[model samples]
Target: MRHAETVTFGGSGLDRAAALRSMPDLMDRARREGTALSILLWRGKPLVQAGSLDQLVRLPMDHPIIKSGRHVDADSEILLGREADGTLVFAHDMSSWLPAGLEATSLNTFLDASEQQHPDLPQDAVFAELRRIMTSLNARDAELAATAKALYSWHASHGFCACCGVASEIAQAGWQRGCPSCNAQHFPRTDPVVIMLILNGNSVLMGRSPGWPDGMYSLLAGFVEPGETIEAAVRREVMEETQVQVGAVRYLASQPWAFPTSLMIGCEGIATSTEITVDPVEIEDAIWVTREEMAQVFAGQHPDIAPARKGAIAHFLLRNWLADTLD
Candidate 1:
C-alpha cells in the first residue's frame, strides 16, 4: 500500500469547494462570469483529446457543446471541483444529442460518431471509454473522469424518491436528491466490492467471469454485503468463487471504479486450502497461477492467457505482486 495513491484515480486532491455547492447564488455567479470549465460525457464516456487519451477535453462554460448541453436540459450537472486557481469544474451529460445521418450504435460507435459530427470542435476531441484509457491518463484527469462518471450515473438512475416514489429534484450541486413529496433526502452511493489477490506459496488464485474476453482472468471479487467487514467479504468472496479457504485478509489498495459506481477495495489474502472446486454459477473458471506464469502474462508473452486489463485493480495488484512491492 506504500504507493496506493499512484493507483489510477487514487488521489488527485481536487478542491471540491463543498461550501459553494449549496450556495446557488454564488454558483450561478461563478457560472455567469465564465470561470467554470465543463467536462462533457456522451453515453458515460468522457470527452478526451484523441491522441493517447492522456488529457480530458475541457470545454469552457460558454463553448458550443456546453451551450447545447444546457439547451437540451438533460440530466443533472454535477460540480466536480475547482482547480488550484479556483476555477470551477463541472460535469455535463450530453447523451441526448446525436449526429444527423449517423445511425446510433453501441456506446463505442456512438462516441466515434459524436466526435466525427463536430467539425467545429477541437480536431482531436472525442468521447473515449474511461476504462480503455484510465491507465494512461494523468492523475488529475483520471480522478475527474472517475468522479464525473460516478456522480452522473447516480443522478441518471435515482430520479425518484425511494421513500414515496415521487420524482426527486436535484440539490446541493448534484451531490444530493431531494424528494418534494416525502421531504426525504438522498445522496450519491458507491457500492463496495472486495477484489483480492489470494496467495498460497508462489501461486495466486484467479478466476474469469462468464463473458470476459478470451484468455483473460483476474482476482476473485464480490460485493461486500450488508453488515459484512472488508476482511470477511474478501474471505467469503474467495471461498464462494473458487472454493478456496482464505485466511489473514488485509487491505492493499483501492480504486474508484465508476462503471455504474463501484469502489474496488483491493486486498491480499492468505489461502489455507488449495483444493480447486469451481463455482459454476459464479465464475467460468478458476485456477492457481504461479509467480513465474504471472510474470509472463504481464509481459504479454504468455501462450494461453492475457493479463487483466491495465486500468483495473486486478492488474494493479498483480503487477505489485510480481514486483513484491505490495506493502
Candidate 2:
C-alpha cells in the first residue's frame, strides 16, 4: 500500500456487502441466528475500552443492550460491512440510552474527554468521543468508528427529504433515505474540501480559524464549491483566504474526515505570491512558516505553535513533507 493509504480512518479492506442490502430478511436472520457482531454508538461516541480507549467493544447481535436498542428504534441497526472472517458486522446506535446523573448539556463538547458506561456493558467498556480515541484504535476500528459516526450524524440531521420537504425513511440498510411523498431517494453525501500545502521556496503557508485553540494552525482548506475541481478549489481557497496566487497544484493525498463527514483532498501548490491579507470573516490569521520551524513544532520545541494534531490529514501531510515521503 502507498503511504497515503495508511492515513487514519483509511480503508482496511472491509467488504461492504452492498448486494445484500436489498434482502430485508438478512439483518433479521443474522440477528435471530446469533450470526453477527455489533459495535455500539451513543450519540456520536463509540463504545471502546474505558482506560485505554483503544479497541472497539463489539457485542453479540443478540446482546441485551442491542436488543433493547432495537426495541426502542428498529431503524438504529446499520450494516457496516462483513469482516474478513465472513462474519457479518453492524453498528447499533444506542444514542437514546440515558445514563444516571448525566449532564446532557455537555455531552459532546469540542473535545469531549468524558465517557459513559452502559449498565449492561462490561465495566471496562464505555462510549467515548471518536476524536479522543481515533489514533488509538487499529486501522479497522478507526474505519468502522468513522463510518458509523458519519452515518448516524447524517441520519439525525436529514430526517426530512430535500426534494419533497417531507419525512424520509431509512433504506438500503442505512445507506440511503427514500421519500414516500415524492419518491425521491437521497444517498449519504460527503462534502469535498481541498487542503493546500502552498510552498514558496523553503516556507509553507498555514492559517488558523477564528475559534481554534491558541497557536494552532493548519493548511488552508475550504469546501469545494459547485462547478469547482480539486485543483481549482486549492487555488481559489488559498487566494480567497490569504490573497496568495498558487501555480501548478498537484494532488498529494486524501483523508476521510468524519467530523460531520468531509473528504479532505490534500494538494501541494507552488505559491507565486507570498504576501498574506487575512480575511477576518474567513480565518483569524495566516502566516508562512519555514520547514525548520515546522520541524521544531513537530518535535515540541516550537515556542509559538502547538503540535499538529495527530490523526488529522494536516499532520499526515506535514509529517510526510518533512520526511520527504509524500509519494
Candidate 3:
C-alpha cells in the first residue's frame, strides 16, 4: 500500500468549485464570459484526440453541440470542477447524437474498439470508450472522465424520486436531483466492492466469471452488502464464491471504477482453507496460482493464463505483490 493513491482515478486535486454549484449567477458568468469549457461524452465515451498521445478533447461552452440544445440542454450541463488557471470545466452528454454508420451491436461490448466521429467536430477528435483509453490519460483527465461518466450514468437511471415515484429535476449543478413533490434529494451513488487477494502460502486465490475471456483470471470480488464491514465482505465473498475460508482481512488500496459506478476496495486476507469448490452461479472457475506462475502471467508468457488488464486495481495489487511493494 505504499503508493496507494497512485491508482487510476486516484485524484488530481481538481478545485471542483463546490461553492459555485449553488450560485447560479457565478455559474452563468462562467458560461457567458468565456470562462468555462466542457468535455463531451457520447454514449459514455469521452471525446479524445485520435493519436498515440492520450488527450481529452475540451470544447468551449458555446460550442455548436451545446448551443444546439440536442446533446446537452441548459439543465444537463454538469459542473465537473475547476482547472489550475481558474477555468471552469463542465461535462456535456452527446448521447442524443447518432453517428453515421453506428453499429449498435459493437458498442458496450467486452472490448469496444470502435470509435465514433461527429460531423461537427475536428477531424482528429473522436468519442472513444473510456475503459480502452483510461490508462493512457493523465491523472486529471482520468479523474474528470470517471467523474463525468459516473454522474451522467446516474442521471440516466435515477430520473424519478424514490420516495414519491415522481419525476425529479436536476439540481445543484448536476450533483443532485430534486423531487418537487416530496422535497427529497438524490445524489450520485458509488457502490463499494471488495476485491480480495487471498493467500494460503506462495499462491494466491483467483477466479474468472462466466463471460470473461479464456486465460483471464482476477482476484475474487463482490459487492459489500448492507451493514457489512469490508473485512466481513471479503470473508463472506471469498467463502461464498470459492468456499475458501479467509481470515485476517486488511485494507490495501482503492480505485474509482466508473464502468457505471463502483469503488473497488482492495484488501488482502489469509486463506485458512484452500480447497476449491467452484460456485457455478458466482464464478466459472477458481484456482490458487503460485507466485511464480503469476509472474509469468504478468509477463504474457504463461501458457494457460493471461494477466489481469493493466490499470485495474487487481493488476496493480498483483504487480506490487510481485515487486514486494505491498507493505
Q: Estimate each model's TM-score.
A: 0.94, 0.96, 0.97
Model 3 Cα lDDT, one tens digit per residue, 43-105: 899999987538899998898878888646446789999998989999988887877777663
List the candidate numbers ranked by TM-score, top first: 3, 2, 1
Identify the leading candidate in terms of lDDT: 3
Extract clashing residue pairs from model 3: none
Predicted structure 3: lDDT: 0.90
Q: What C-alpha lDDT values do all the predictions have?
A: 0.85, 0.87, 0.90
User: Which is the winner by TM-score between candidate 2 and candidate 3?
Assistant: 3
Worst 10 residues of 3 by lDDT: 67-76
Candidate 2 C-alpha RMSD relative to the actual structure: 1.6
RMSD of each: 2.3, 1.6, 1.2
Candidate 1 TM-score, true structure as reference:
0.94
Better of 1 and 2 by TM-score: 2
What lDDT does candidate 2 reach at residue 73? 53
